[model samples]
Structures are given as C-alpha cells and as structure tokens.
Target: MAPDDIDATLGAAWHDDSPWDLLTRLCAFDDRLGGGPGERHAADLVADELDSLSLDPRIEPFGMQRWTRGHTAFSVHPSDERSREFEAVALPYSPAADLRAPLVDVGHGTPAEVEAAAVEGAIAVASTDSPAGERHTHRMEKLGHAVAAGARGFVFHNHVRGQLPPTGALQFGHEAPIPGVGVSHETGAWLREYAAEDEEASLRVDATTDDGESRNVVAKLGPESDAEVLVLAHYDSHDVGEGALDNGCGVAVALAATRLLTEFDLDSQVQVAAVGCEELGLLGSAALADSLDLDRVKAVVNVDGAGRFRNLRALTHTSEAMTAVAERVAEESGQPIATAEGPHPYSDHWPFLRRGIPALQLHSRTPGGGGEWDRGFTHTRADTRDKVDPRNLRTHAMLTALLVRDLSTTDPDRVDTDALRETLREAGAEPGMRAAEVWPPDWD
Candidate 1:
C-alpha cells in the first residue's frame, strides 16, 4: 500500500463511527454475564454484523457450568436481636450460605497474609487494591487463600471510592466452597470499625449453578495460507455492570476494525474471534485453542483494552519482535503507544500464550498508574457507556486495524516456556495461579 493509500485508509478511519455505534448497541444489553440472556443477544448481534461483511461468521459452541447471581445480605451484630445491615453483592460462584463468624482483616489477602492472619473459621476481609511496590493481587487468589485458611466466608471491598460494590468470579467453571461478597469502600470502612467493636458478623448469600452453553464468534478474511493472524476480544462481561469499558469497548473496536480491514486485500488471513465466557475465566478462548490448529497461527492480537483510553497500550508481553512492530506502528501513525514488558494471564491472550504464542495484549492505558485508573470504574456498576469516549474508540479502531495489518507479516517472536515460567514466578503470579487451580503441572 502507498503512503497516500495508507493516509487515506487512516484518515477515513479516524472519522468512523462504527465502533462507537457498536459500543452503544452492546451497552444496550442489561449484562453479558457468561450464559445470561444479555450475552446470548450480544453474541447473535455480533454474528449478524460479521455476516454483513461477507465473512460467514460461525458460532463455535462450548459447554460450561454457568453461575447466576442471587440476593445477598450482610450485617454486623453488636447485641442479640439487633444488627446493622449493609449493602453488598455476592461474587460470582459463591455458594449458598447463612453464617455468623468473627470478621478478620487479612490485609491485601495475599496467601501469606491470609495464612499469617490465621483466619480459621472467621470472615476474612481483603481490599482490592495493593500497596505500592507490591505485586497486584487477584480476587480469586484471595478467595482461594481464605478458603485454604478455613475461613467460613470472604469479603472483597473496593479500594476506589464509589458506592458501587465490586464483583468478580470466585473461580472458573465451578462454585466456591464458601460464600464471597463485595462491598463499597465506605461500607468496608464501616465494617473495619464495627468489626473492632461488634466482635461478630453475619453474611448470607443465595445463588444457583447450572450447566449452559456459550460461544466464540469466528470469521476469517485474506489469503488462505497455512499461517494466519488471530484477532481476539471477548464479548462477555460480568453481571454487575453495563460492561461498556470492561469489554464492550474491545468487542466494538474489533467489529469496527473488521469493517475497515475488509476494504483492503491483505497478504495474510486474519481470524476474528469475539469470544464468550471470558469474564468467567477465558473458557471460550481456551476452547478455541483446544479445537483449532495453533501451529498454523503466525501471531495474535488480543484486544481487551483497545477503546477505553486514547493512547493504546500495546503490551508486547516481552516479545522483542512484537515490541519493534508496536514502535513502528506508533512512529508511522504519529501516535505514541506505550508498552509493558511481561506476560499476563488475566485476559483472553493467556489461552494463546500458554502454548508459546507471541501475543500483543491491547489495553487502554490511562494517564497515571495504568490499571488503577482503568479498574477504578471498570468492574463495578460505574462501568457504563459514559465512561467510554467516542474519540478513543475511533482512534483505537484505526490503530488496531493498522496493527493487525502490519502483524500479518511481522513474523513475531514466540514465547519461551522456560522464560515464561521464570517470569511468572518472579512476578508473583504462580502462587495466585496455583491458588486459582489454573497453574499447569508442566509449568512447574
């Protein structure tokens, strides 16, 4: 493609409203929680959009243990027959529970912290935020630690102050042994003070688990060679919010990019997947990898963070070749794309990365401390359509389209397993992985 042609492509892309329009359509759903009605609607809508591009999209189905949220209640008791009730929401996969136990603070809820706190038979409370210089802790890992410590219940409170109670899964594809709930920062503060004075707590959670089906929306274009590029973004989000910023942005951006890429005749095939069940722990992408020929995949561009912020966070995942390409794209587009230097297993990219695939994790990197800003609103009820800027969506749609176009022939570096093991170990990810039961025995 000539400079003028490239210029024309990007220029037209800048004003495109397809991404923003798609974002609105996606956010219109009540919630895209794994197998919920909202998710089913969103999945069919995405397939219809893909079919419009003549890509012949298919819904690759998979079975999963679906979790449905139910009513939750929590209170502190200072005396018999009287209690102070607080608002809370059950974390996904929490088992039905009606329990009273001493509330204990397991600061940050790292395995060591929970174990050292000796929270046996107590209700362990942990913050979602980590102190500076400490590796970030995941909610599932905290619940794992709490369960292992013999806690009867778990409490995850947001560090960011919003009345919004945080919600995330307790585990992938299964129910937790104990109940877990999330509360707002204010409620958490009240709990800390009341736990000191009251000496007892009561938490009740009611939920249901059942077998269900989910899918990966797949489409392909360009040359039908043995090697191809995989462009992935999940359409599923948690039941707590509109999911606009959490993943609706990524899916919308992917759809928008697909619209633009269809106009160009490329040298390599691009397989687009708007996968499901990611919010429940990447089941769709895991199923996709298990059912496909990964050896035929040349590179992967997993978009989980594309449209939330203006500047794209083109995380190279320690691949020097991928990093070089990101820099080239940044320089050519006159846009600065920031990069991080390690592999992360928290998103759809991990299913591909586990097999040594070189993947670029595209996320929205905000101005200050990267993830803190993004997560301040993402997982909670505050992650509505207003948080997503239309300007950012269009810019990402164009840049990601350009990135996928370039990655078609970059011959990106493959991750080394030994290096991946060591890096994850040093980054304090192995313990959490093990806690969540996701650590492969072979990686050890």
Candidate 2:
C-alpha cells in the first residue's frame, strides 16, 4: 500500500468516534472476578449495547468452581529475633494452611528436583526467571507439581533484570491443590541466601473459596444461521488494577465493532461475547466453548489490548483462510500486523482451540521499542485508560468488524489448517499438535 493509502485508512478509522463512547460505557461496570455481581452487571450493560444495535442477545450458562481471595496474610520471621517482619500476600486459590512450617530452599522447584529433595510439610522458595508472557504459567505449574508431591506452599522471587519488584495477586487454577505467592527479588534472594547459610525461615499462609454466579453477556446478529462467528473480550480485571488496557480496551473495541457491523447490516451472523471472570482461569470462555456446538462455529476473533496502537501483534491458532482475512483487514486498516501460530492458553481462545475451532488473538504494543513496558502493565494497577490511544482502538474495531463480516459469510471447509500451521511455525510456534482424542459416547 502507498503511504497516502495508509494514511487514508488510518484517517478513516480516526473519523469514527464510536470506539471512545464504547470505552467509556464498558469502563462504567468496574467488572472484576469471574462470577461477581460486577461481572453480571457488566454483561447486562454489554448486552443492552448490542440490543441497541438491533441484535438479539443470548445467555449461555455453565457452572464453574469459582474462587476469590479472602483475608490473605503471610509473613517471615527471622531466626535472629531482632530482625523486622517481612510481609507477603497469598496467591489466589491457595488452600488455607495456618501451620508454622520450617522453610526449605528449593531452587526453582522443578518436578524432578522436588522429587529428589522429597520436600514435604515444608514451604518451598524458588527463583522465577521473569514476569513476562507465560512465565507465571510455568511458575504456577511448578508450584502445583510441588504441592502434589506434598509441599505445603510455594514462594517466587523475581529474576527480571533492572525491574521493579513484583506485585499484585498471584493467581492459579481455582482447583489447584496448593497455595502460592510472588515476592520481591530482594526478599526472595534473602530467603534463598539465608537458607543456604543454615538459618531457619518460618512461613504461614491462609485463604478460602466461595460459591458465586459468573456470566457471559452475548449479543447475536442474524438468527437461525448454520454458521456463526464469535467475537470475544473479557471484561474482568485483576485485583489491584482497573483493567483499562489488559482487557478494558479490547472490550471497548469489540463493542465498537458490534455497532459498526450492525449499522452496515451485513448478511453473516455475528455474536459479541463480553465474557466475565476471565482473569480467574478463563471461566467465562470455558463455559461458552462447552455450551456452543463447535461444528457451527465459523471463526473466533478475540480482541485484547486493542487501545494501544504503537505496536500491533495478532496471533492465531485459526485456519489459514482466517489468518489471510485478518492480514487483509490489517492492510486495509493501515495497521502493521504481525502473525503468530499460537493457541495462547491464557486467553479466551484456548477453549475454542481445544475444540479444534479456528481462533485468533489480537493485541497492541509500544511503537519501535520492545521492552518490559509492552508486557508489564498487566495484572498491575498501572493498567488504566490513560494508557489508551483512541486511534489504535478505532483501528482495531474496524479490522475486527471486517474480519467477522468475511468469516461469517465464508464456508468452513475453505479454511486450510496445513497452510496456517506452516505460517504459524515460521512465526515461532512448534508444529501444531495432533487433533485431541475424543471420548465418552455422548461427546459432541
């Protein structure tokens, strides 16, 4: 595309002012956690917005073992007796354990290492590589493995270079068998060194779970359609943050897309899913995926971090045809689009990918610079609307609308998984996994 063409595309995006309105409306909900009233109210607001666009909304309900943090407290007592108390917060979904256990220094508690040490009834402290994409998943997995081997709880020390101390809620599977938390690099280093020197460290933790109703606010355009396209974004935020950028931006963009598509009156069927409780293990997405028929799904486009336009990254675990459609839309919108082959387990797309449905993840980044800033704001209180660039949000909304329109009208058989796989591998993904095995006589 010519420079003038690019400018025009961007200009067109900026001309539409719906994205800003949508952002303001969605942020009004203050939605957090999967099943809380905030989530339910947020869903209602999104559904109302879709209804105003002349779309009929559907609510698909499923039960999830919901979790919430309650009165978490942890502290370390020094053997010197004169040392001040070092404090820590317990991770979400951690089991309540009030025992004053003897602390054991387990270096990066991998499965094999934990087994070799036979750590039981002792708190394990390990160093984390860094807090970046998927690093938390690795740490949590290690913590779970250790808990299964009889460890009491786990603590993580930050290892990121020249970074601020790690803060915010430590989250894991709601059903995880053990408790976990993240600590400052300084504190973690102290614990490790103290253990190495044969000084005793004392640890304690407490937490609980409560029952609640989580919801997915869905709005549909076109009724009784054989093929459907689902557009998704989670409205929930982590404990300490307002979730303006982590997902509030994506939710706003999706809402804007819904408005544009409705105004255009496209023939294809579309659904906007403003999911709740995503931060708590993708509960809303998991429920929606299970409730829907995979065979009827034409495609899923998940919008996340869409309000920042400086750097754009679009990852897909969808068919080649869908990826092509995304690239074309990006081209037309005059946004730089980079593709990746991924079934990003952390996002709402995981449920669709597991069902063998085509899915995509869209994100924005800082221009030119690739540093901690691009990935750091999430889960922290720093994620707020001030970081949002309205121009970027508008571009994302336009691209999303175009992609959904095209996919909803296309045939599922035209999608090419093989080509998509090659594209993804070149983008840094391992070859796609073989289709998952199906079981149970009643499976869909």
Candidate 3:
C-alpha cells in the first residue's frame, strides 16, 4: 500500500465503531471471570467479529481452578460491649473460612513488619500502600508473609480514599492457605486506632472454590507465515467492577488494531488472542504459550492496560531491538510513546518473555510515584465505563496498528533463560518474582 493509502486507512480506523461497541457489550456482563458466563459471552462476540473479517477464529478451552466470592465481614472490638463492622471484599483464591482471631495492624505488611508483630494465631492487618522508593508489594507476597508469621487470617487496607476496598489474588498457582479480605483506607484507619489502644478485631470470610474451565480466543489475520506476531489481551476481569479499565479497554484496542490490519496485507501473520482467566492468573496466555511452537512466534505485543490515557506506553523488558522499533514508529507517527525499562512477570507477556521471546506490554502512563497514586478505582467497583474516553481508545488503537505493522518485518534476537534471569536480577525485579513465586525454580 502507498504511504497516502496507509494514512487514509489509519484515519478511517479512528471512525470505527466496532471496538467501542464491543467494549460496551463486554462491560454489560457480570460473569467475565475465567470460565464464567461473562467469559463465554465475550468469546462468542470476539469469534463473531473475527468471522466477519474472515479470520476463522476458534475458542480453545483450558482447565483452570476458579473461585466465587461470598460473604466476608471484618469487625473491631474495643470491648465486649462495643464492636464495629466495616465493609470488605474477599480476595480471590482465599480459602473459605469462618473464624475469629485477634487482629494486629502491621503497617504496609512487609516481611519485616510481619516478623516484628505478634501475628501468631492472629489476623494480620496490612496496608496496601508500598513504602517510598520501594516497589508495590504483591498481594500474594503480603499473604505469604502473614501465613509464614502464623497468622490465621489476613486483611488488606487500601491507601487511597473513597471507601473503595481493593481486591486482588492472594494465590499464585494454588489456593491460598488462609482467608484474606480487603478494606477501605477509612476502615484501615479505624483498625490502626484500635491497635494503638490495644484493642482486638475479628474477621470472618465465607468463599467458595472449585475446579473450572476457561478459554482463549484465537484468530489469524494476513496469510500464514513461518513466524507470527502474537497480539494478546484478556477479556476476563474481576467480578466486582465492570472491569472497564483493567482490561475492557485492552480488548477494544486489540479489536480496533485487528480490524484495521485486516484491511491490508501484512508482512507476516498476526494471531489476535483475546485471552481469558487473566484476573485469576495468566491462565489463558499460559495455555496459548504452551500450545504454540515457539520458533514460529516472532514477537508478542500484549496489551493489558491501554486507552486509559491519551498516549500509549510500552514496557520493553530487556529487548533493545524492540525498543528501537517502538522509537522509530513513534518518530514516524509523530506521536509520543512512553517507554519503561524493566521486567514484570505479572502480565500475560511473562510466559513468552521467560522463553526469550521479545514482547511489549502496552499500558497507560501513571504518575511517577512508588506509592500515593490514585489507583483506588482499579480492582474496585468504581472502574466503570465513564473512566474510558473514546478519543483515547481510538488513538491507542491506531498506535497499536502501526506497531503490528512495524514489528512483523523484523525478527527479534532471542534471549536465553539464563540471560533473562540475569536481566531480572540486574533490574532488581528478582525479589518480586521470587515473592510472587513466579521465578523459574531452575534459575536458582
């Protein structure tokens, strides 16, 4: 296609309504959890869209252990006659238990704090906010610390305001050992005050866990090639909020890019993956990675969190070649692209990255801060459709389309597992990886 023709196509991509329509439809479902009703609905819609483009998409089912949230409550006891109950939500994969124990508030709930507090046979209270100059502590890490300290239960207090209780997974690959719940910052403050006065708190959580199934949606654009560029985004989300920001935008961006790219022939194959079960874990992406012949995969562009801001940011982990490509695309498009140099194994791209495949994680830029950012809306009930803007969504899709076009022509240098491990150590990401128990056991 000529440069002028390419320009016209991209401009037309801005006016596309399929992406926004899909986003709205996805947000309407409440069961987007892996293998849940929402996931099935989302997969059907994506497959239908791909069929319209003659992509012949298929739904690949995978086994996953899923959980359902139930009743959870936290109460503070100043005395036998005085008690206060606060709003809370159970963390995913937390064991279903109804037990009461003394609560001890451990600020930020780091390993050291858990060690310092008398947490044996008690419920440990931890803040979700990380310390200054330190990385945000993973929910699993905090739960692990509490469990190691002999704590019978765990409670997470959000740092941001607005009565939003933060919820996240406390298990990595297995079910959590104890019950875990999240509370708002205001509730946390009450717990802290009671702790100062030498008071006790009680927590009771009743959740349900069972073996379940989920799937990954796969569609192909352009002709078959030896190497394909993998485009991935999760359609599953937490059950609390509409999940509009955590991943609804991600699906929209992927659809928009795929819709536009299908209009013209590409240099290589593009496998559009709308994965499921990311909220529980990267189950869908993991299944796809396990099934793929790695040699046939050239590069991966995983959009987990995009369209929340006007500009798109790429986290290029130890991939100098991909960094150069992103830079070139940014220059040519006259669009500012933010770049972060680090290794993060929490998203869908980690499975591919660990295997030495060059990958990019697309997300919106957050303010510079180790803590104190206004992220209370994430993982909470406040993440609604209003938070997403159409303009940002369209711009991000155009940028993604350009990236797909640019990355298809280049073959990335593969970094071996040892080199990848070394890169993580040098980047100071090893500790977090170890804490999350995602570090390759063989590497150690």
Candidate 4:
C-alpha cells in the first residue's frame, strides 16, 4: 500500500464509530451458539451491512447434529458429612450420562499424567491451562485422555478466577464417549482438596441432541482475479456469555473494515466471510474448505482477536507474506503490532493454514504479554459489552484495512506441508487436534 493511500485510509478511520455500533447489535443477543437463532441473527446483520455497500452478500447454510444443554448435577459424597453440590455447565457435545465414582485429580491432565494416575473407573479432574513452560492444554484433549484411560467422566476447571467456568466443546460434531463439565477456578481448588481425603463424586448431565443448521455470510469486493484474499471471522459464540470478546468484536471489526475497503481499488478481490459454528469446533470453516476451490485462494486473514485492546498481533503461521505485511503495517502506521510464527489449530484460520495456504490469525496483543494463553475474560459469562473499547475498534479497523490492501497485491509464499506439520507439532497442536478429531485434514 502506498503512503498516500495509507494516510487517506487513516483519515477515514479516525472518526469511525460504525464498528462499535455493529458490536452493540451483536452483543444484544445473549448467546450465538452454532445453529442457534442468535448466530442466524448475527449472520443476517453482517449480510445487511454488506448489502448496504452494494457488495452482493450471500448466506451459505449448512447442517449438523447439535447439542442442547440441560440440567447438570455434580456433588461430592464424603462418608461422614452431607453431600455438597456446586454450580457447573455441561460441555457442548457431552452425551447424557450419570455416574458415581472416585474423583481423581490429574493435574493438567496431559496424556502421560492421565495414564500414570491409573484413573480407570474414576472421574478425572483437570485444569484448563498447561503447566509452566508447557504448551496450553485444551479441554478436549483432557476429556479425550480421560476417556481413553477408561475414566467414567471428566471435569475441567477454569484457569482464570472470578467464578468463571470455561466452556468449550467435548468432541467435534459428535457425542463424547463420557460426560464432561466445567467448573469455576475456586470450585476446582475445592475439588482438589476433597480428592485428597473423601474422593467419592457423583455426576449427572442431561441434554437433547438433534439435527440443526447454521449459515455463513460471504461477500465479494474488488475486480475479479485469478486468486482472492480471504478475510474471515466467525459469527457463532459460546452459549455462556454475550461473546463480545471471543468473536463479536471480531465480526464487528471485519464489517467496519469491509465498509471502508469497498471504495478502494485492488489488484485482486477480497472475500469477506463470517463463518458460524467455530465454538462447537471449526465446523463452518471446515465445511467451507471442503467445498471452495482452494487453488483460487491466495491467503486467509482471520479476524478473531481485534477490538478488545488497542494493539493488534498476528499469528502468521510461518507465512512469510503475512509476517512481512504485519511488520510493514505496524512500522508504516507506527502501531506496535507483534507477529508469532507458529501455528495452533484453535481458530477459524486452521482450515486454510493446514492446506498450505498463507494464513494469519489476527488478535489483540495480550496486555502484560509473555506467552499467556488465556486473555482473562473470553468464553465465560463475563464476556459482556462493557469489556470492549470503542477507540480500539476504530484503530484496528484502519490497520486491518491496510493489511488487506497489501495482501491483495502481494503473492504469498505458501507454507510447505511437512514444515507446517512440524510447526504445529512444535507448538503442541497435534495433541489437541487428535483429541478433537479434526487433525490430519485431507491435505495430509
């Protein structure tokens, strides 16, 4: 992008409040779970915004077997005292189950630790985060390991406090073999204490499983070209909170950027895609990858971490073109944007990245940053409208507009298959992918 164009875009971005308005509209819905009404509303909002720009937007709907939450009961049965029950939520995709077994604390619940503890016939408990110097452990990995070891059930505790219980899916688009639930940080500590002495625990989870549908809003901009740049965000959020941070912020930022970029000329088209069902696993994007012509996609920039903070960073995933643009934009705009060269199969970008496409997962730079995986308040009940700042939205929209413009003109150095696999292996993504059953994408 030229300096003249950069200044022009910045001038337009300084006074923009449209992103905050879009975010407010998105936050009005309590939860945007995949295949739910909230997600459909969000998808329609994005399409309407794009239609206002004369960009012919389309909603691509897909179907899947969905999970509906019901009552979940968990209690500790000490021999000498009355049973104590705590508040918890059933993990999505957890099957209907009831069991009473010994509660075993498998700290971090890595595969090796779960095996060493001999937790067969017991309900294994694990933390949301990995140990110091260890890669972040996902809830699905912990749950999968427990079931593999013949554990009757699984309990995941949030690493963050303030009574927030982390909510994520058990298995990708399928009923998990055993029951799973999440508890607050403080409650998990109490459970560990109880495990040392009176370890008996009884758990019951009930739910209605059925078929459902979800939609993705997609719009095309700029003149037709051989390959296009994919700008992506997910409209679906977890059922636990308003989802302002995890993805509401992301979709809003993407809309604001698309609104401005409609007027700019580009060498290639930019496809704005608001996918659904990311929280239940990357179901929407996975479906898209299976259907779209991968050969015509030059790059993918997934907006997942913007608008919550002032500074933005990109997980470049070994894409040289992406890393260069991130650094160039920060230097040119005088913004403190950081770039990480590793890959983690956690967000909407994973589908494209795994297929040797140049992919970037853009997120807010973690404040007081130093390899902290959890960003305090996402995926919990506290992820509300008050947590986002309007100023951050405008700033990110300007920077993203510039990044997309640059990617449109520059050809990406696609990541090699073996090297990409090694990068994922080094970043500890293999275990989580294997657990979620989304690993070894068709490209492998």
Candidate lDDT (C-alpha), each: 0.86, 0.64, 0.83, 0.85
Please give the range of 10 consecutive residues that has the lowest summed lDDT in model 3.
367-376
- Count clashes in each candidate, considering only residues at least 3 apart in sequence or on different chains: 1, 3, 1, 2
Off by over 4 Å in 1: 79-81, 370-374
RMSD of candidate 3 to true structure, Å: 1.9
RMSD value for candidate 1: 1.5
lDDT of 3 by residue, 392-424 (tens): 888988889888898887887875668778877
* Global local distance difference test of model 1: 0.86
Which 10 successive residues of model 4 have the least lDDT summed? 365-374
Is 1 or 3 the stronger prediction by lDDT? 1
In order of lDDT, best first, we have 1, 4, 3, 2
C-alpha lDDT (0 to 100) for residue 357 of candidate 1: 89
Q: Per-residue lDDT tens digits of candidate 4, residues 264-299?
A: 778898999999999888888888888789999989
Report the lDDT tens digits of candidate 1 across residue range 1-444: 666876787788778777888888888988899988899999999999999899999999899988988789998887555888989999988988999998888878898888788589999999887756677777888988898889999999888787878998889778888999999989889777765564689999989989999988999988888789999999999888889988999998888888878876677899999999998888999999998899988788999978887789888777888888888989998897888777767788887888888888888776576463348687888889998889888888888888888988667778887898898899988988888877877776
List where candidate 3 sits over 4 angstroms from the true fold. 366-376
